[model samples]
Target: MSVPTRQASPAAPPPASVLPAVPVEPSPDPEAHLGLRFPEGFGWGAATSAYQIEGAAREDGRGPSVWDTFAYTPGRVANGDTGDTAADHYRRYAEDLDLIRDLGLRSYRFSISWPRVQPDGRGAINQRGLDFYRRLVDGLLERGISPMATLFHWDTPQALQDDAGWANRDTAYRFADYATAVFEALGESVPVWLTINEPKTVVQNGYITGHHAPGIRDEPTAYLVGHHLALAHGLGVQALRATGSASRIGGALNLHPCYAADDSPATSDAVRLYDGYENRFYLDPMFKGHYPEDVLADQGPGSPLVRGIRDGDLEIIKQPIDILAVQYYTPIYVTTDGGTVQKWPTTQAAWQQVYPPGMYDILTRVTRDYAPPSITVTENGLPCADEVGVDGSVDDAGRISFLRDHLAEAHRAIADGAPLESYHVWSLMDNFEWEVGYDQRWGLIYVDYPTQRRILKRSAAWYRRVISDNSL
Candidate 1:
C-alpha cells in the first residue's frame, strides 16, 4: 500500500501585499484570568470528497458522474477546470493518510464515489472501486486513524442523471440499493457513515440554479429533486439498518442560521422564508417526520410540484440517527425589498455570508429545538486566496483566524450542553471546489496542483497543536 512520491511544485511567488491584519479578540489564557478547554475526548479531523480529490476519474472501472459531464460542458466550471485529475488522491491515498496521521487526527472523513462503486449506478459492484477504499481504510487503520465514510457527496453517476435523476422517485430506491451495497462492502470496518452530504446543495445547485452538475434550471424540477433526495436519505438509512451493519449512520446537512438584515417586518419575513427553505425543510422531516407547514405555504398554489410522501414515508424518514453531521461554513443574511427576499453580504460563492457566530447559534438551536442527537461539525473552513511566503511557507492568517473563531464558538456551544461530539475541517487539501473549481483554497494543507505537492499551511500547524493538546 505504498503511495508514489510526487515532486513538490515550486512555491508560488509571494503576494505584493500581506493579508489585511486580523482583528484581535479575547483569549482564554489562564494567566490572563480566563479558563477554557475543549471537552474531554472531542474528536478532531479533516474531510475530503472523492470527486474533489480522487482524480483518477476514469480509472479502476469507475464510470462518469454528473460532475464529469458538467465540467466538460464549456462554461460550467471556472477557468475551464475539470476534476479529471485534480489531486490524484485515488493514486495517492497512502501519502494522504500519512498527512492525516501527521496532523494527529483521530478520524478522517472521506466520501465514496457512487459511480466508482457502482459504475453504471446500479446492479454491479465495481471490485476495483471497493479495493481502492479498502486500501484507504486499511491505511488509516494502520496509522490508528478512524475512517468516517460519506456515502454520497454530490457525485451522482451520470448514467442515473440520464435516466431522470432525482426528479424521479425511483432514484430514491436506486440510492437505497447503492447504500446497501456500500454498507455490505465496508460496514465491517468503517464505524461511522454519512448517508448524504447537503441535499439542498444537490437540488438547488444541480437543478434549480443550474450552477452545478447535471445542470437543469427548472424550479419545479428542483423542488421535486429535493423531496426525492430526502426520501432517498430516509430509504438509505433504512437500508443500512436492514443490512444489520454495525456502523452508525446519518446525513451531513449544510445548515446555516438565517438572520434578518434589519428589524423591518419584510426583513423578518425574509429570514423566516430562508429558514424554511434551508433548515426546516430537511430538519423537520428527519426529526419530526414531516416538512414544515411554512415551507409548504411558501411553495404557494401555482407550483405543480407536490411532495410525493406516501403513507409511512414519515415513519421511514424518522429512523433514529446516531449523529447529525452539520457542515457550517457561513450563515445567510436575508433582507426584503417590497415583496422579494434576497441574500446580503455575499461571498465569492455569491450566496454565503461570512457569519462565524452563526456556527454557535445554529448548533445551539438544533440542540434546543430538535430531539437531542450527537452532533459533529463535519465541515467548517474558510476559502482564502492563500499565498506562500518568500521563505516558502504559506501564511494563511485569515484561515487561521477563521478556524480559531469558529472553534471558540463550538467550545461555547458545548459548554452550554449541546451534545457536540466532533469537529472536522472542511478539507485537508485544496482541491476542486465544485463549479467554482480550484480558484478557492479551503484546505489547511496547501496543494500545488501541477506537481501534486502538499504544503502544510499555518492553520494546519495550529490545528495540529490543538489536536496534540486536546484543547481549542
Candidate 2:
C-alpha cells in the first residue's frame, strides 16, 4: 500500500516537559524473601486469548480476524501452523474449565474475538457467537471462578483491517460501539473488562516490524494506529461506564522496564528515548492526559502520527481506569546508540530476558507514577520447549523456577505498597502461539495437539500449592 496522504491537522498544545518518575522502594530484609506470602482476597488464575485457543473459526457464525488472514498467508507463521484446531478449546471448554477448577483457580482472564460477536466488527450481532462466551462465562462462574474478559487481543476483525484498521480514527468509534454491545450482552458478569491488549504490540510488531497480524512495515502508520488504539481504549472505558454496570475496566499494556546498558551519561539519553517509545508513549496519555512530547517529537513534523492529531482527541484518549493490567516478559537495556543489549539470560522465546527484578521495579514504578486504583499482573510465564517424560508426565523445571522467582518479586512489590490485586499466568494450557506457532509453549498444562490431551505440568502443581497455601 502506498503511503497515504497525510491528513492536515491543527496544532494541539504540547504537554509539559517529560521526565521519568521511577523510584524503587527499598526491599525488606533479605531473609524476608525466603518465604513469600500474599494478603487475603488476592486472586490467583490463568489467562488465554480467543484466537490462540478457540479454534472454531468458521463455526457458530464467527467471522474472520486478522490472525486468520495472517496465519493463512504463505510465510507469516512458523511451520505453516494456524489456529485452525488450537487445543480444540471451542469444543473442549467444559473440560478446560474443569482443569481451571482442578488447578484451584479463582479467576480466569480471557479475550473476546471482535469478529466473533459482530462478524464485520460492526452492524449485526451474531447470537451464536455471543452464546459461546455466555456458556464459557457461566461455566467459569459455575466452577467457582470469576471471569475477566478482554475485548480485543490483537485480533481485529478482517473487515476492520480492510477498512484501514486502527489507522483510521473511525475505527475507534466502532470499537466503542462494539464494546457497548458486549457490555449490554455480557453485563457485569465479568468483574474486570480490559479494553485492548498490548496496543504497543500492534504498533511495534504489527505495523513497525510486520511481525504480527495485518502486517505492515510502515513506520508512519504505526504511531497513528497507536493513537487510535488508545482512543479506542478510552472510548471503551466510557462505554462501559455508561452501561450502569459495576464492572471495572482498564487497558492491558505490556510494559518493559528500560535501563542503561552501562553507567555512561551517553546511554542515559538512549535509555530515556527507549523508555519513551516503549513505555511513556502509552503511559503518559492514559495517566497524564497527553502524548509523550519526546515520542511526538521523534515522529517529527509531517509524520502521520504528528499530522493526524486533532483537537479533543487527547481528551477522549485520557480517562480514569479502574485497573492497570500489566504483562511483563522482559526488560530493554539501551546502549548509547539507541541499540539494545541482552544482559540477562534469555528464554525459549528469544525476545524474553529472564530478569525477575524488572517485575518489582515495574510494579513499584507504575504505582509511584500512575497510581492506578488496582494493578494486576495479568500475563507472566516462561515459554519452554516442553516435552512429556517417559513416565507420561510433563516436567518444566525452568517454568517452575521462572514462576517462583517472578512471584517473589511480585510479592516484594505488594509488600512495598503496590496495590496489586491479582496474578495470572500467561496461559492455562499450551496452544497456537502467534507468529511462532506451536514452537514455543507457555502454559502450565501441556497440550497434545494431536490427541487434544491436557496434562498438568509440574509448574501447575507447584502453582496450585502456592495458591492453596497463599505462600511460597
Candidate 3:
C-alpha cells in the first residue's frame, strides 16, 4: 500500500535551534547538594519485559514471537542462548512478587506478551495466556505493589512479521485491535498502561543493524517501520481511552541525548542530526504533531518512511498521553564526521556507559521542550559481572554505586523542575538479556537460572533502604 498524501507539501526550513543548550556538567540545585528527599508518593518501582523474563516460549496456546524466531536462528544470539526457560518467571511469578514486597518496591512494571494473549497477534484472546498476567497483577496488588503494564515490548507476534510487520501500514490498526483485547481483559485493574516500548530500538537495532529479531539491514524498511510504530502508539493510546479505564497511557521511548565529542562546528552538526534522529523523530510527532523537517530530508526522497506517512497520520500519532515515560541509560557523543566516541566508563553491555548527568539532561530537556504533563524514568540500570559467593550473598557494590549516582541525578532533575514523578530500575532480577543472552546482568537480584533460585544482591538490599527512607 502507498502512503496516502494529502497534497504536495513543502518541507519547512530547519529550526534555528532543534534542542536547547544543556550544560556539559550541570550542577544540581542547592537543595540537591544537601540531598533532598523525593516528593511524597514518588513511585519506586522496577521493570521487566515479557520476552526478557517470562520464559514459557511455547506453552498453553502461546505462539512464537519475532524474538523467538531470531533466538532460535544460529549465530543470531550469543552462545546460541534463547529465552526458552529464562529465569522461569512464567512459572515462578508468585515467588518473584514476594521478592518485590520484600524489597519494598511500591510498583512492578512488566509487559504483556502479545503472542501469548492473541496467539497470532490478532483475533480471539487466549484465556490461558492472559491468566498468567492476571495472576501476576493480582499477586502484585495483594502485596500492595502497583502494577504498570506495557502492552508491547519488542515482542511482535511472528504472524505480524510474516505480514511485513510494522513496515506495513495495516499493522498499526492490528495493534490497536490487540490493545483493545488486552484492555477489555485487564484494563479494570492496571492503573498505568504503556502502549509501546522503545520503537527507536526497533528501527535502529532490528532494521538498521540487524542485531535484533526479524532482523533486516535496510534503512528504507527501518524508516517505514518507525512510522508504523508511531501510528500503532497513537492508535494504542486511543484504544486505552476508548475503554474509559482511567489509566494513565503513554509510550516508553529510550531517548539518547546527543552531544558533540569536541567543540567543533562539524561535530555540532553531527549532534544536531543525531538528536533529530534519536530524540526529535519520536518526541515531535508525539507532542508537536509532525516529524522534524531535517530528519525527513536526511532520509531523502527515496525513503519509503517519508512516503508511508499518510494524511492525518500525525494527528493520530499526536494523541494526548497522560504521562511521558522516559527510559535513559546513555548519551551519544558524535565526532565531526558523525562517528561515535566513547569517553565514559562502560558497563558489561558495551553500549551502556556510566553517565549519570545524562539522566538529568534528558528529563529537563523533555520538560523544557515537549512539556509532557508528567514524566517517569521507566528503565535505567547497568549490567555487571555479578555472582553469588560461597556465603550465599552477592556483593555487587558496583551496581549499588551505579544506582546511587543515577538516583542522585534523578533527584536533581526533579529538584530542577522536571516534574519527574517516578523511577523504576530496569530489571527486577537477572533474566534473558536479548541478543547478548544472560551474559550481561542488570538486575538487583541475581537469578540462579539452572535452579531458578532468586538471590538478593547487595544492590537490592541498599535499594530497599532507599525506598524506606524515601531518599538516596
TM-score of 3: 0.93
**Candidate 3: 10-residue stretch with minimal lDDT:** 1-10
Q: What tens-digit string does per-residue lDDT give for candidate 2 at 275-360?
A: 88888888899988988787788778888987888888788778889999998888777777776666776666666777899999
Segments of candidate 1 deviating more than 4 angstroms: 1-35, 301-304, 337-348
- Candidate 3 error regions (>4 Å): 1-34
lDDT of 1: 0.78
lDDT by residue (374-459, candidate 3, tens digit) is: 99889988777887899999977777767778888899989889988899998788888888887878899899988888999988
User: Please, what is the whole-model Cα lDDT of each candidate in the order they appear?
Assistant: 0.78, 0.84, 0.83
Error of 2 at 17 (Å): 32
TM of each candidate vs. truth: 0.90, 0.93, 0.93
Best by lDDT: 2
Order of models, best lDDT first: 2, 3, 1
Candidate 3 clashes between residue pairs 3 or more apart in a chain or in different chains? none
Per-residue lDDT of candidate 1, residues 1-472 (tens digit)? 0000001000111111223333322234311211358877778989989999999989989999999999999998889999999888998888989999999999899999999999888889899999898899989989999899989888889888889888778888899998888888777698889988888787666776677788887766676677788888889889988988878888888887877667889778666766787788889888888887776775654543444656887787778898999888666555553122223333344344456688899999999988557998788876777888889898776666667778888889998888988999978998998887888788889999989999999889888988888775
RMSD of each: 7.5, 6.9, 6.7
